[model samples]
Target: MYSIHRSFADNCMAVTAPVRSKGRFTIGCDIIEADKLSNRLVALLPKTLDLRAANAVRLGLRELLINAVEHGCLEVGFELKSKIAESDDYLQFLLERQKLPEYRLRTVQVEYEIRPQRIVFRITDGGKGFDHKHRTHKAREDDALAHLAHGRGIKMSLRIFDRVRYNTAGNSVTVLKKLA
Candidate 1:
């Protein structure tokens, strides 16, 4: 589903907080920031969860980070995103957006903790938020929108995490997963 999305975050260093503790980091609107951060955070996670579960978390985490960068930081709406996803130069288009003054300085903030019983993540973006309540939650294989590139991230996050809570302003999201 995210085949074209792979190159956006290749071979970049992540800005991260300390390991094995609660930490916070911020990233720019550009694409590399999302993938790098997710890989770094997953490396810092405890090893108790089975490999399958860990992989799920990794995939979901990356998706959420991408969502924040695309929708929140870069202000790319669903309709425009749908159009962009079908194009060959999706990453180039996103990079072009980052060059714009309005989006150049926008950022996404991530706060997280590695706890014994659960993991908590708070992802906040600087752009004006939307009505998150109106966003889709289901990503069924039969769903046409879910088959698209842009809409699956939030659905993946909601499916993999125990809880996903978005702020009233929709700029921030907090996700929790029990470790048992």
Candidate 2:
């Protein structure tokens, strides 16, 4: 038997009881301020996954969560991020944005569920959502677009997750990967 604990702001905590051999299970959920995410958060996942899958989850979740923090919460759009990437001012911009009251107060909510066949995650960010349909549908893998940097995260998410679906407003995303 094992349990997973998730800590949120204000010292709040959520704990998942020992998982059973049931068909599906709702593990736990957590809320973290957009600016507060870190690599250490990866430890929040259960040890149920093997090394390779765990690494994939860490990388995929980090990218998507950072997208939520940077794009969804901080309102850094594609064009601006592209320019920042070229100028190598992204770190500075992130620092400045972290101080903004509006962006500072926003949060990202994450929910996790374990099922007999897969693991599901629902991640939502505080921001005016975008056109998820257009973004996901029109994303092309041609050489021209592949050479760009901004869309790589989304492209990577598409390939990594068994399924990746975004809300109509695009502020929320649900991803799942098979567990075996």
Q: Against the true structure, candidate 1 has what lDDT?
A: 0.78
How far residue 41's Cα lies from its native spot in candidate 2, in Å, is 5.9
In model 1, the runs with Cα more than 4 Å from the true position are 1-20, 137-144
Candidate 2: residue 49 Cα off by (Å): 2.6
Could you tell me how far off, in angstroms, the CA of residue 160 lies in candidate 1 after the best superposition?
0.4
Could you tell me every candidate's TM-score relative to the true structure?
Answer: 0.84, 0.74
Query: Which 10 residues in a row give candidate 2 its minimum summed lDDT?
Result: 22-31
Looking at model 2, residue 72 earns an lDDT score of: 84
All models: lDDT? 0.78, 0.65
Candidate number of the best TM-score: 1
Model 2 lDDT per residue over 1-180, tens place: 122222321111122323322221111111133223423333444445554565566667767887887788888898888989998888788878867887777777777776556777787888898887766765545443587866766776787789999988899999988877
Tens digits of per-residue lDDT, candidate 1, 96-153, equal 9988999998899999997778889999998788777777434434465645656877
Q: Cα RMSD for candidate 1?
A: 5.0
Model 2 lDDT, residue 180, Cα: 77
